[model samples]
Target: MTDTTDTAKCPACPGRRHPRQYLCNTCWRSLPSTTRGRLARRDARAFQRLRELHRALAARTPLAIIRVSR
Candidate 1:
């Protein structure tokens, strides 16, 4: 058996690289955004939720704070 695929060196560090990937898993998600003009998954999800809330408010929907756990 043998393994063959394209690979690239991660600019963050030098070591094992993944196929067809510029950065390793650690280095890839280690930063805020994996690439430019991109938002982190968590951030993107939060923005979506905020947009929904704004839309509801514009539509005259009442919003209340049931609880503030944070």
Candidate 2:
């Protein structure tokens, strides 16, 4: 079985991310509240929203400037 406790590197920075999470604490906290709220929602569009976040991050977009569509 896979280790659920393993830590992974954060995509936005060199910080360590907890297992099953997308970003490290610092990086996550840096995101705008609206973005965080949208990401927290568990709905059919959740995956698509996550893709938007990841795409922004991959493009080196600033956390405060990142916006996800509904």
Candidate 3:
């Protein structure tokens, strides 16, 4: 299979590059509205969940704790 995608530079990391990535979907979706501006309410929820997971991992909490509610 062949992929026809253009490489795009990640907005957050100029030195790093991605193929056909726009704001690198993961970062785009994770970005808080306060940082990115005017995000849908649903996207905000997803962003919050991402932050919570990050916080838990940073605090060395077990993955079990993070997955309990999910």
Candidate 4:
């Protein structure tokens, strides 16, 4: 038998849950206001989606982010 419920450690912050979120709370907080504004302005929907995807990645949700146009 094996224990599979262990939470993975964050690459940037050892022994932490990595915030299990987009860019991690620390990184997100550290981002420059200008950068945040830029990200907010360009493709707001895509940016929001990216954040969700990043959260999924942090949780090992087995998902990928891609772009498509029609």
TM-score of each candidate? 0.34, 0.84, 0.34, 0.30
lDDT of 3: 0.46
Tens-place lDDT digits, model 4, residues 4-70: 2434444334433333333445544544554444434546465565565455546654222221221
Model 2 scores worst on lDDT over the 10 consecutive residues at 1-10
Candidate with the greatest TM-score versus the true structure: 2
Writing each residue's lDDT as its tens digit, candidate 2 over 1-70 gives 3543688878889877896677888988999989988888889999999899999998999988888876
Stretches of candidate 3 exceeding 4 Å from the true structure: 1-42, 67-70
By lDDT, the best candidate is: 2
The better-scoring model by TM-score among 1 and 2 is 2
Whole-model lDDT per candidate: 0.42, 0.86, 0.46, 0.42
Stretches of candidate 4 above 4 Å error?
1-21, 42-70
Give the winner by TM-score: 2 or 3: 2
lDDT of 2: 0.86
| lDDT by residue for model 3 (1-70), tens | 2333555655443433356333456555555445334222345365675565456546766443332112
TM-score of 2: 0.84
What's model 1's TM-score? 0.34
Let me know the TM-score candidate 4 reaches against the reference structure: 0.30
